[model samples]
Target: MRWIWIDRILEFKPKQSARAVKCLSLAEDFFADHFPGWPVMPGALMLEGLAQTGGILVGEANDFKEKVILAKIPKAVFHREVLAGDEIVYDVELLHLRKEGATVAGKVLVGAALAVEAEIFFAHLDQSRSQQFFGDHNFVFTGELQRILGLVREAGKRPEQS
Candidate 1:
């Protein structure tokens, strides 16, 4: 099953940055097991959510042509626990981009407070090698994720409220 952490894309700027949010719901399965009564969103999952947000940004940077995978996390620190009913935002910026890979620095924000900070690095799979195994189709940015980018673009068209 495809695990999509973020609920929707809030803002997307191709090759530059992206912002997305995930609202923790008490109904999420993990909560039931994480703690019998006091549920908390796992920090690793939070990082995964951040990676998904940054991954989309990196994929869009190359027009979704490269197979982008989280190669390494050089840094990540959790400042606060995320609980059900809280909304967290993933704000990521493209720090470096190249043919081989790219790096992104992001912050997980719960309102005005910083919940988590991380630096994610993505590596592009060798086209010739990957095609033999994964085929010509781009698997990194699937239909669901493309829809997210589309959603933000559409939202951008609406007249702003003064």
Candidate 2:
């Protein structure tokens, strides 16, 4: 099963940045076993949320023709634990974009408190290169995510206006 950490795109700026939200619920399956009685979102999942937001922003800059993959995490820090019932807001900013890849800085906030932050690198893959490993499924999955995140219009007419 695939998991989409972000619940919605609160704001996005084509090549510059994106802001998204993820509302944690106790009903989520992972919460059952993640910590038994004391449930807190895993640090790794928080990182993935940041990566997803950054990846989508980078992919949009290229019109989604290239598959964006997280390449490296040069820096990461967690300020506090994220628990169920918390709403995490992710802010991803583009640091650099080049032919080979892109670099991004992202932060997660719970209310006014910082929860996690990281510097992420992304590699762009053309369909040819991406298909070799992901076949067509990855593209489909990404398209769905973009739609759910409101990065693309549901009618498929055009990219989000702003």
Candidate 3:
């Protein structure tokens, strides 16, 4: 199955930062196998949501010319459990950007409480390399991603360009 991590953008700033939300539902398949009776969202999945948000931010900052993949997650702290019916808000900030890679700091909050936080690093790879890396992963960059990229481009544009 395809993994759709991010739900929608709550707030966004071009080349700077973004906040997005992911609502976890009881009907999700992972809950059935994660623990059976006492199902809680996994730390790794929570981190994946944060990483997805950060990837989107970094890709936007680079104008989406290159495919960005999670290279490393240096630090991750899970402070609370996330159960079904919880909405996870991910706030990601671009720390640095280079030709080959970018670094971002991200946090996952369940309501007002912190659930998970991490510093993620991403590497920009060529299209062929990305395809090889994510082989048969069934990943799709949807229209929403395009719309977000357009917004980022517009926001990054100079007054004369706009």
Q: Over all chains combined, what TM-score does candidate 1 have?
A: 0.91
Better of 1 and 2 by TM-score: 1
Quick one: ranking by lDDT, best first?
1, 2, 3
Instruction: Please give, for residues 64-118, the per-residue lDDT of candidate 2 as tens digits.
Output: 7677888899999999999999999999999999877899999999989999989
Q: How accurate is candidate 1 locally (lDDT)?
A: 0.89
**CA lDDT, candidate 1, residue 161:** 84
Question: What does candidate 3 score on TM?
Answer: 0.79
| Lowest-sum lDDT 10-residue window in model 1 | 126-135
For 1-162, candidate 1 gives per-residue lDDT tens digits of: 358888889988889998999999899999999988988999999999999999999988888888888999999999999899999999999999999889999999999999999999999876435667777677777777778888888878989988
Q: How many residue pairs clash in each candidate?
A: 0, 0, 0
Candidate 1 residue pairs in backbone clash: none
Cα RMSDs, all models: 1.8, 4.6, 6.3
CA displacement after TM-score superposition, residue 121 of candidate 3 (Å): 0.2
Clashing pairs in 2: none
Best by lDDT: 1
Task: Please provide, for model 3 over 1-162, each residue's C-alpha lDDT reduced to its tens digit, 9 standing for 90 to 100.
Answer: 457577777778877898988888888899998879877999998888787778777877766666777889999988989998899899999999888888999999988998888999988765445657666543334455656545545655637554
